[model samples]
Target: MRRIGLCISLLVTVFVMSACESEDEAQTFADRDQETVKHTTVKPMSNKNKQDFQTLPNDMQLAIVFSSMIRVSEAFDYGIGNPEYFVRSSMTEGEADIAKENLESIQFENKQLKKQNNEAVALLQKTHNQEMSHNEMQQLKENRTAFFEVTESMIKLISQVTPKNAKKTRQQLDQLKKQYTQYSAESVKIMNSIVKKQGADKASFERHLETMLQKQPGQPMLSELY
Candidate 1:
């Protein structure tokens, strides 16, 4: 009986030590997994937020500037483009406030869009580490690469972007602005011609305006107003 009791005590001691070793090994594995996960987080676009515009390529930097300008243009259009009533070409305080609020919101959206684009690029760079929506993600990567590689395509894209995109990711803003200026000049010439030709047919102005819209769709609202 005494021998049986001693054997029971030894068995219990062995079981407890075995259990503790197993627990320690499991904890070690869990710690290793945590360390592996820490390496997979998204890195900042520029040195952990020390990002300077100068760090990017000159063309890329210009593109970003152009995008920002486009957003401002959109805000301007949204705020003052149309109003229910105009009191001598000025808006009511409430209307003005709404416009200002909208402009600010749009600008913030532009910043977020830019950040998303950058994040997408970063994700692509880390393709092996994560899964992505292959179709949209790959297409965006390819399209941006293709566009940036071609001077003409870049110019055309920059020229035609909605005010919002232009506000965030555009370059060659001056060139785009210059193109608008040139279009304005040409439109003036066409309008003068239309005025001369409109002496007989009142609808000729509409036809000419439509013709301009067909040629320059980017400035449709402005053309329509003219």
Candidate 2:
């Protein structure tokens, strides 16, 4: 009976030891899984946070250029008045070059469009020697209106592309908004003068505006106003 009792006690000890080993193994696995989950979980960075130039699209590159221009222009408009304010945001020398190129392109395109518009107006005046029909006159008025509308939009867009300080950006934007309002009034006066002198109808004006819009490169995806 003593031997049997000793055997039974030994059996019980073995079972308890096995159970403890199994529990320890399960706890170790659980801990490892938790660590793996922690390591795998990560936050995705936003496009705005990315600093690399190569990652940006062509339109975005152009926008950066325009943004710099806007900032510089705004600085001058707001009494900050430094050209460096525009180019300072560029990440690299190459980016600065690109920005400069974009500005040049925009200026060039504006000049070309203005020249074309003047020529079109002149041609219209030459063609309409006699009194035109009321319908023809109305058409001319509509075209002139559309052209001015597009011009104002372009100015506003250009102004919006300018970058500003975080503290003053909002104020700068407000200034741009006001400037656009004034710009529109001035544009209307100019358009009326062109129409009155040239007798060019609205259809010709719209076609010219459309051509200008088509010539302009595609805007950036990130642009706030295009």
Q: Give the best candidate by TM-score.
A: 2
Question: What TM-score against the true fold does each predicted structure earn?
Answer: 0.21, 0.25
Per-residue alpha-carbon lDDT of model 1 for 1-226, expressed as tens digits?
A: 0000011122222222322222222111111111221121222333444444434432232223222222222222222121111111233455434433333332333334344345435533332211323444344455443322332332334333443443332344333333432322232233223223323232433343334323321221211000
Clashing pairs in 2: 67-161, 70-162, 71-162, 71-163, 139-202, 140-201, 140-202, 143-202
Q: List all candidate RMSDs to the true structure.
A: 32.4, 31.4
Report the lDDT tens digits of candidate 2 across residue range 91-204. Answer: 344544433343333333444344433433333333332143344434544554454454444333333343343224334434544443343233333333333344434344
lDDT of 1 at 141: 51
Q: Top lDDT: which candidate number? A: 2
Tell me the spans in candidate 2 whose CA falls farther than 4 Å from its real position: 1-101, 127-226
